[model samples]
Structure formats: C-alpha cells, structure tokens
Target: MKHFLSINSCSSQELLELLELSIDLKKLYKSNKRVLCLAGKSLAMIFEKPSLRTRMSFQVAMTNLGGASVYVKPEDVGGIGKREPLKDMARILSGYVDGIMVRTFAHETATGLAEYASVPVINALTDWSHPCQAMADIMTAKEHFGKIEGLKFAFIGDGNNVARSLAFGCAKLGMRIEIASPAGYELDKGSIERANAIKPGTVVQSSDPIQAVKDADLIYTDTWVSMGQEEEKAKRINDFQGFQVNMDMLKAAASHVRVMHCLPAYRGYEITDEVCECENSIIFLEAENRLHFQRALLKKLMSSN
Candidate 1:
C-alpha cells in the first residue's frame, strides 16, 4: 500500500490481506512473541486534531514493531494548513521520517500530504473520513464472526466521518452497511453512490433506527456532535432524540449481535450506558485492535514497497 488515506484506496483483496495480517499480529501479541516488521523505521505523527486513541495506538504500534515515533503536536507545526501549506510540511517530513501519519480537520490535508510526500502517508483521521478507525472496527468484527462477508452492519447516529469510512470499508468487504441518520445528517450522496458501485445494493440509508438495526449482526453508533461542532450540540441533541442505541434498539438486532463504538463515547447520548456496558459490547476490543491493525498497516506502508 502506497498510502492509506481512505478505505476506497484499497481493493477488497488488499483489505482482507491487511485484516489477516492484523489477525496474525494480534495472535503474536497475545502469545508474547515479538514481530518486528518495522525494525528500523521511524514514523512522524502529526496531530492537527488531538485524540487519545489515535495518538496512543500509533505510538504503541510503532514500538511493538521495533520502531520509534515522533509526536508533532498541533503547536509544533503551527497546526497544519495554518503556518504553511500541507505540501511543504509533507515534503519536509518525508525527508526525515520513514512514513507520515496525520490527524487533521480537512480531508484534503491528507490528500495534499500524499501528493507531495516521497514516503507513505496515513490518514489518522479527518473530517471527511477516519480510515484507521474503520480498519480496527472491521478487524474486531472479523475476529468475532470469522469472516465479514454478507454480514449486516448497521450504524445508528450522525453520519460523520467514522460512519462514512465504515460504510465505504464495509461495502468493499462485502458487508451490507445500513446507516440511520437524521435528515440533514445523512451520509454524503456521492459516498453512498461510490459504495453502491463496489457492492451493488449493499449501502442502505434510512432515518429510522429500527429499520437500520433490524436483524443486523453488528450495531454501531458515534457521537452526534463531533469536535468542531460544539455550537450545534443543543440542536443536535434535539434532532437526534430517538436515535440513541439503547437496549430497546439492541433488541431489534440479532440475538447475538455485537455493539461497537469508536471511543470518546458520550454515554446516554449517542449510546446508552446500558448498551455500552452490556455483554455484547465489543467497544474495548475494537479499541485495542486499533493497535494491531495499525501496526500491520504501518508495517505494510513503511517496511516495504
């Protein structure tokens, strides 16, 4: 993989390979075996948008792979696209680091970095997509189900970046994705179309939470209000009144259906505390697999061509 800016950047076969690699790495980690695929590499991590999971996961992933990471705080580079052009920073970082991983507000910042960098660029997160999170989510599902094909995955809440990436990634992997969001918060039409092109009739969108979660093998939800949208909190709360993934919603899904959240969860809002703390919740497992999946991705992107 040259870059991992978006799930669409990878083919279905490539995603499966990454998932398999993640499984192997996870087993090795569990067995206390050292697998240093990126023995001598160095990754430069840039955080335009701060995150606990993104920062810790990538840092631990690099260390586990026998490599090191340099954390570039937001102020260090004057915040990407603020002090200078993303291309210039990308060019400069490529000369020093083996690979670049950046979490930014704009998706184009990631694209801009990839355009100029000589090394691989990974999009840790952006306003338009969070591909890394999608990878970890898929990895968690595959771990439970043994395979992801033909599984019904339902996302209930704001159709934000996480939801968008999940839709794209799930559809590409032959999993049908049903997303239920408020009218104004639906997944971008273009993204839905693109996903449909990959797996016809796999991407389904609705405004009803029941329709989205009905018989789904996995139920997912994310915060209705994201980092930069604090001003819309009250309005969003009112808009998403019945969208919470509570126990009642879980009952609509399969008996053994799993629950997933991408983290920094606001309990009683997007998801209730009951559901999040339930036996079916794999949220922590999903969070932990972020390290393994990302370690595999870093190894693939930085260790070789």
Candidate 2:
C-alpha cells in the first residue's frame, strides 16, 4: 500500500501528474461520469482533531469513488494510538479498511501509522505538513494560470503547514515563492532550508508583505491563528496587525494577480470579504478542486494492484 504523508514523499513529476489527474477528474464528473473506482472498498478515517473541509471532502471523495468511509473519533478507540499503542492500532485498522486517513497534531503520529499499517495511510492534516491541501492549491494554480513554471507566487501570513507545503511545491516545480511573515512566524527554518536545498533559487523569504508580493502572480495567505493555538490567538492578532489581504494590499500585486486561501477564514483577520469574493479571486474554484484532488489521490492509492 502506498501512503501520502508529506509533499516530499512525491517527486516534482508526480506532483504535476496529480494536478493533471485532478483536472481530468473534474472533466469526467462534468461529463456525467461518477467514477466509483474503489467500489466495495472501505476506508477508515481517524480524527485526533476536528475538521470541516478535511472530513467532508474525503468522505465525499470516497463515496464518489464508490467506496465508504468510517469516521473514528479518539474516545471511540482508547484515544488513538495511546490506549493500545500506535503499531497495534495500525495492525488493527489494516485488517478492515482498504486505506486509513488520520488528522492529528503530530506529524510523527501519521508517520508511525504509515510505518505499521499494511494499508495506505494518508495525512489529512498535521501540524508539520498539509500535502493534500497543497495538492489542491497547485491544481487550482494549474487551472487558473494554464501553466505552472515561471509563475511568481507570494504567501503572506503565519508560516504554518500550508505555507510550508506551498513553498515546497513551488520549489519542486521550478517556480518562485516569496513568503512574508512576522519576525518569529517565518516558515520553519528546517522546512525552508530543505526546499531551498532541493531547488535552490526558487524560495525567497521576506518580512514585508508588499515587498514579498511585488508583481506576484498568485497571492496567498492563511489564518493568523491555527488550530490548537487558541492561547496565542490574541497575541497573534496583535502581531499580525496590518497584515490582512484587503483591497489596498491586493492592488500592490500585479494587475492580473489572483488571491487564494485555504478557508474557514477569519474575515477581518487573515483576509477581507472583499478580496475573498473578488472577481479575480479563484478561492472558490480552489475549494472545489479539493474534491477532484482527493478523487485522484484515492484512485492512486487504492489502485495499487
């Protein structure tokens, strides 16, 4: 069984293939082809954290592929990898499900599950990486731009998992990313250094959003405060104080620039509603691509015959 735990788990060529696959799937759906490629196959989704998009999109994706997904809450199973040990849980889940997806706080928890499970284990969302969302975002970029390389994108806000994956994706594809964050909120030095090492000239770090986005093609940002960091929310708000993607900042980029966000957006915080619903915003299209990307992902993981 193959697993998708991080962006680095896939090569640049494979990432492009996923983008193409997602486009193909969207076309197929429009042509009245509801693919059930995984018919009779079952997947178990273990959630150590809460979600809206991750849960809905994956479940719907499995169903669209003619498969079913069973949701497993922490309390339902001795609190996931703790009550009976991670390896033991993996061994148990592998028996009944064709695949497993876990959303949790730790990256190692997903890696541990992948290590022990005979079935494919997916990282739905972890504190350290968000490969699936990046996959969808890149697909959006491909559809919107009609090309991937040579695109100058900028990510402005907290350097969370989303930003890390986006930076990796851009670097791997020979594109440039200008990331701007408050002093201490920059992308994990480790993740940035690794992406830079792989594709040296493609990643740039900045402290000013305007400078980061100078003539950028795709402008991006994420919520100022991430999940499980409620205690730091107030502090983050104060620190990220003039950083929202409003009209003034949008005009700072190129005339053809498009804005994107992985939603559940805090309106006045990370971005303004004016930008979210702007005609230039492909944000909704990006959200829709999540379904197609998961369809392609499931087809890839379960078609390992």
Candidate 3:
C-alpha cells in the first residue's frame, strides 16, 4: 500500500508530479469547474490533535473531489496506542474506508497505521513530519515564485516537523534550503540524511538567522512550542529569543522575499504582526493552498490504487 508518512517517502520526480497536479487542480477550482475524480469513494480521517486547517482542508478536499469523509474525533477513538492496538484499528478502518488520513502526536502511531492498513494511509500531521503541509507549502511557493528549483528557502525557529518537511521537500525539488534553530533543536538526523541523499550539499544548518536569510527568497517560521511541548513553553520562548522573523529579518532577505507561517502563530513570538500582515506575506494563500494540494494528493494516492 502507498503511504505519505514523510516528504522523503516520495521520489523527487513523484513530488514534482504531485505539485503539477496541485497547480492544475487549483486552476480548475478557480474556473468554477467541478471534478468528480473520487466519486463513490470515502476517506476516514482520524485526528488526535485539534486543528483548523488540517481538518477543514481534508474534509473539504474530499467533498471537492466527490468523495465523502467521516471525521473520527480524538476522544471517540479512545487514543489509538492505548485503548486499542494501532494495527488492529488500522485493519478495521481499511475494510470500511477507501483511505485513511491520521493526525497524531506520535510519529510511530502514523507509521503503525500504515503498516496494517490495506488501503493507502496518509500522514496528515505527526510529531516527526507534516507531509500534507509540506505539499501545500511547495505549491504555494511554486505559484508565487514561478518555479521551485534554485530558490533559497530559509526556515527560522525550532527545527520541528514543519521545518523538517519543508527542508526535505525543497531539497528534493532542487531548491537550496537553510534552517536556523537554537542549539539542540536542529532538524531530525533521518530527515537531514534523506534530503542530503537526494541533493548533495543542498541543505544548510545554521544557528545564525541573519546568515540563513541573507539570500533567501522565502522565509518560513512555525510556533516554537508544538503540541505536547506545552510544559516547556517558558524555556522554549527563552531559547528562541532572537529567532523572530520581523521587519529586520526581512531587510536581510531578498527584495521580494515572501514570509510564511503555518498558522496559530504566536504573533509576537516566532513572528511579528507587522511582518505577517505585510504585503510580502503569503501566509493566507499558503493556508488556502492546503485544500487544493490535498485534493490532488487524495486523487493521486487513491485513484491509482
């Protein structure tokens, strides 16, 4: 079965194809056309973490593609790893649904679901990676910049799943990606290795945000403290003191640099309100692309299988 657990799970060529489909899908949607590619199909969405974009996008994506979706709330499932075996739940869901999309705190839970599910399983969001978010991000960048290759993408903040996924996707597509994070918060070793393998010397890890965004065409930042890290919020806020992407940081980037944040942003923390609301920010467009990109992803993953 095919699964989208990480950006590296798909080859460079496959990622390009998915991006192309996403662009085509966006065009189609804007033209007021209806696509019934997944007619009579259904997707089972399992969410362990509450979200606005992830949930709404996937549900709307299914609806746009003529597929119905059933949302399984976090409490309804009794937590996959504890109440019931992940493998057992995966098997059961696979029998009834055409596909499964899961958002969880643990990366292993997402992987475990894919292991036993007969149908394709997509990692909606996990601690280790957010592949769907990465796809939308790439689609947004490509739409704005006219191309993906050779663009300098810079990520500033904790090297969490969003950073890892964005770096992995950019590197795979031949774009230069640099990440600036505080000490001990670098991107995952596995993700770094995979990106390096795809495009040698394409990923740069730095502690200096100024140097990272020196020539960047795109600047990305996410919340410093993610779900399950609420206890360490104070320390994280202290550690990420100078990592904020404000107007000063934009001055160091390219003249046409675009700022992005995977929302629920701590306005004054990881980024400033002035920067997010500025004319150069494509944050809202990036968020909206999730719906279109996931629509293409669902069709690609389910229609083929």
Best by lDDT: 1
Q: Candidate 2's residue-wise lDDT over 1-305, tens digit each? A: 28999887788888887778889988998898987789999999899888888889899999988999999998988777677999999999999999999999999999999999999999989999999998899888888889888888889898889988888898888788888888899888788899999888777888899887777999898889888889999999999977889899988878889999988888888899899988879888888888889889988898643
lDDT of 2 at 163: 88
RMSD of each: 1.1, 1.2, 1.3
Count residue pairs with overlapping backbones in model 2. 1
List where candidate 1 sits over 4 angstroms from the true fold. Answer: none
* lDDT of candidate 1 over 14-51, digit per residue (tens): 89999999999899889999778788889999987889
Residue 289 of model 1 has an lDDT of: 91
- The alpha-carbon lDDT assigned to residue 256 of candidate 2 equals 89
TM-score of each: 0.98, 0.97, 0.97
Q: Cα RMSD for candidate 3?
A: 1.3
Q: Which ten residues in a row have the lowest lDDT in candidate 2?
A: 296-305
lDDT for 121 (candidate 2): 93
TM accuracy, model 1 = 0.98
Better of 1 and 2 by lDDT: 1
* Residue 127 local lDDT, model 2: 94
